[model samples]
Structure formats: structure tokens, C-alpha cells
Target: MNDSENNLKRFGENLARIKKAKKMSYRKIAANCDLEHSDIKRYVDGKINPTLLSLLDLAKGLGIHPKELLDY
Candidate 1:
């Protein structure tokens, strides 16, 4: 895979790890972030790269800093 694809995969893994560590569910996170459940799943599944805004929303929903999500 390309660098971008690899990055997305890593980001997805990090996102999933962090979310799980927080004891949060995908559906709950999606609802809190005002994002579609499918979209959140795509990111966590490494099927799509999330936009900056989506990342911001996710960070907010997770009660984390945006940089935390990008630390991967």
C-alpha cells in the first residue's frame, strides 16, 4: 500500500485503541460527534481517511485533544 494508505491504517488503529481505552462504543462516539455510524466505522476500519473537521469532532466527543488522535 501507499504511504497515505498506511497512514490511514495506523490512524484507524490508533483511533480504535483510544476509543476502546476510553470505554466508549463506536455508535456512542458517532452519536456524540454528530457523525454517521458508517463514517466512524470506515475510519476505524481503515476504509477511509477522515477530514480535519471530522477529527476535531471526534476529539471533542472523546474528550481528548485533537493532537492525541493524530499522534499515530
Candidate 2:
């Protein structure tokens, strides 16, 4: 895979891992981030990537710093 693809895959993996560890559902995260449930699912599944703003929202919803998401 290319760099972007690699980053996305890693990000998705990290996102799923963290979400599961936090015991949060896609719907709960979506509600907290004010995003669609399906959108968060897609992001966690690596079906799509996220923008900086979206990442910030996700990190905020997860009670983490935005850099934590990017650290993946």
C-alpha cells in the first residue's frame, strides 16, 4: 500500500482498538462527535479517511488529544 493508504489503515486499526478498549459504540462516538454513526463506522473500518477537524472531533469524543489519533 501507498503511504496514505498505510496511514489510513494504521489509523483505522488504532481507532477500532481504542474504541473497543473504551467500551464505546459507534453510535455513542457519533453522538459525542456530532457525526453520523455510519461515518464513524466507515472511518474505524478503514473504508474512509478523516480530515483534521474530523480527527479533532473524534479525539475529543474519545477523551483524548488530537495528537493521539495522529500518533497511529
Candidate 3:
């Protein structure tokens, strides 16, 4: 994959890792982030990219800095 695509995949992997570590399901995280569960699944699956606002919401829900999600 290209660098940008690789970054997206890495970010998705990181998100999944964090989600699994927290023992949270897509529905639960979606509820916390005020997103749809399908959107969360798409994010984890790397089928879609997240917007900055969505990233911020996810970070807040995950109790992490937005940088952490992008660190990959």
C-alpha cells in the first residue's frame, strides 16, 4: 500500500487494538462516541476514514489523546 493507505490501516489496527484491550464492542464504542455501530466497524475494518471531529470523539470515548490514535 502507499504511505497514506498504510497509515490508515495502521490507525485502524491501533483502534482495534485499543478497543479489544478495553473489552468494548462496536455498539458500546459507538454509543460512547455518538456514532453508528456500522461506522465503528467500518473504521476498525479500514473500510472508511475518520474525520477530525470523529477522531476527537473517538479519543474522548476511548480516554486517549487523538495523537495516540494517529501514532501508528
Instruction: List residue ranges in candidate 2 displaced over 4 A.
Output: none
In candidate 1, which residue ranges exceed 4 Å CA deviation?
Answer: none
Instruction: Give the winner by TM-score: 1 or 3.
Output: 1
lDDT of 2 by residue, 1-72 (tens): 899888888999999888998999988888788678898888887889898889988987888888888776
Q: Which candidate model has the greater TM-score, 2 or 3? A: 2
Over the full model, what C-alpha lDDT does candidate 3 score relative to the true structure?
0.85
Against the reference, the lDDT scores of all candidates come to 0.90, 0.86, 0.85
State the lDDT of candidate 3 residue by residue for 1-72, as single tens digits: 887777778888999999998898888887787788898788888888999999998887787888988877
Model 1 RMSD in Å is: 0.8
Candidate 2 residue 47 C-alpha distance from true site, Å: 1.6
Better of 2 and 3 by lDDT: 2
Per-candidate clash tally? 0, 0, 0
